[model samples]
Target: MSFTQRLRRRLFPPRDAIEGYENEELVDTICRKTAAYQGQANWPLVADLTTVLDFGGGAGVHYKTARQQSPDIRWAVVETPAMVRRAMELATDRLRFFERIEEAADWLGNVDLIHSNGAIQYVPNPVRTIRSLCAVAPAKLIWHRVPISEGEGRREVQTSYLSDNGPGQAPSLAEKLVRYERTWIPEQAFIRAHEGYRMAERSPDPREHGTYQFRFVPD
Candidate 1:
């Protein structure tokens, strides 16, 4: 058996597929983000009609539970073609997946929510990525789990084995081949130029990744 099969068998005896394991992996994110949006008046969620674009959303397991909590919401996760294929298979009336963020351009100024959790760092050019997101002009943006350097804002391309979710039972089981990723500490100028939004909140991620979460809202 593969290492993943062995680990899953040993770690999650009752879980039959990798998808089931992914749901468990994203449970905390679903719970915490759901709670944050539930009490808020703007993006990420709306008690009434809502639409969310989850950039670099993988498999979209995080949205699975969220769909139950906010049935009135429309969610689209933009990911790689392979991930999009799998997530698309699980799509429902309230949830869908896309291969490109630009597909939701029609939602400009009305998307309600845009979220990118642990995503920007992997983007080739985060500035360009955020610009595209800003163009969509959602009411609120959830920028979470972003690793940043303390000194200056610079882009980096590093090779490392990355995992989909948090490290599971045996971290080695989920390590992908060596891959290069670009990350930035994020300069303030980009958000400043966006015009309609303001950085309303900033907080250190509770985790140890030295990342910060920023929330942008209508100015």
Candidate 2:
């Protein structure tokens, strides 16, 4: 496995602390906002969408919010085993869960949409993966990823909490956002790899952190 994949497996171990906090209302709100933005940008395409594949779907939170926004939409959450189990527990008829992307691929001949949030950064072959997914689903692809930029270090510090102090005992939030100073791919590289896709929009996070939203469509 690649370093990125290994890091994800370790940091986001099946049912870790982060998983426990995923169902919070704030998380739900953010997901809803993201889905709304995607819908607006790809409104014409999504209007006819009935089934969607939520790739790297974490605990089915996004799926839940998406269902509320589009009741006629059916969804399948594709994630790692740990997340898959959590999703199954939260599953409804319109929302199902799968552990592998290939499993979901079998059910979708040409899906209307693909929702991928905060997951592709760990993919070793992002270009190939994107192409494969796009080939299987020609409608629309909404991918959100963290951008690597200059001035930040690539190492992230993580803290482990030990037992029983009061609420005050909780450790300060570890700086998990590592800056990949030299790793930012140039726009040309993105254009080259993502051949048939046109850059519809590029929105950078206002916090000065390197996260960005690049909306694209197949040419």
Candidate 3:
């Protein structure tokens, strides 16, 4: 990992109880809303006897909700190590957890649906990742990502490089905020990246957030 990535992981550890609580609530709301929408859309194609791959699924909140909504479907939750542990603790036998994408990819050939919400944006090469998923799974892909927009802010915090001796001088705020930029995938760029896939639906989030959902069938 790069210096910044290492620092980010340490400072803002992936397992933040407060943030996880809030995120779980938000994800639950989104899942319920999306499930209702999909139900009304008459997309009964995969309603029964389908396998779901919840890629980058944190805490498996969506996986639980989806399983309840579609009891017949098999579910797999793929997330980071910390998150996989948490999900495994909460998940049922119908839902399995994988700590790595490669492990999830191994089962992709058997999946009938791939779902990723607010996760692909973190990927360094989302196009390649999506293509890999598509290669293994020949089925519907439902993905949501934060679209590139203005007025986004990124900030970093720094503390003294502590030692056992005593206290050290703290880093300046200017030194702390090393990198700040809006990180979002443009809609056109995303569409172009998955051009071979047939887009079934495109909808902006009702909350007026920069997030968007694209439901498509892999070619």
Give the poorly placed runs of model 3, Cα more than 4 Å off. Answer: 1-46, 149-182
Query: What overall lDDT goes with each candidate model?
Result: 0.61, 0.54, 0.55
Per-residue alpha-carbon lDDT of candidate 3 for residues 1-219, written as tens digits (9 for 90 to 100): 369956865786432222322234333333333323322223344456457788876655555455555776666777655556444555566667786655765654487777887666655566677666666554678876545444432222212211100112222211211111223665566666664687789888653376778888865
Error of 1 at 111 (Å): 1.0
TM-score for all models, in order of appearance: 0.67, 0.59, 0.59
| Steric clash pairs (candidate 3) | none
Better of 1 and 2 by TM-score: 1
- Model 2, 83-119: lDDT tens per residue? 5554465567777778767677676556777777665
The best candidate in terms of lDDT: 1
**Which residues of candidate 2, in runs, are more than 4 Å off?**
1-48, 149-191, 206-208
In TM-score terms, which candidate is top?
1
lDDT (tens digit, per residue) of candidate 1 on 71-138: 66777887766555544555777667777777854533268788888777776577777877887878
Clashing pairs in 1: none
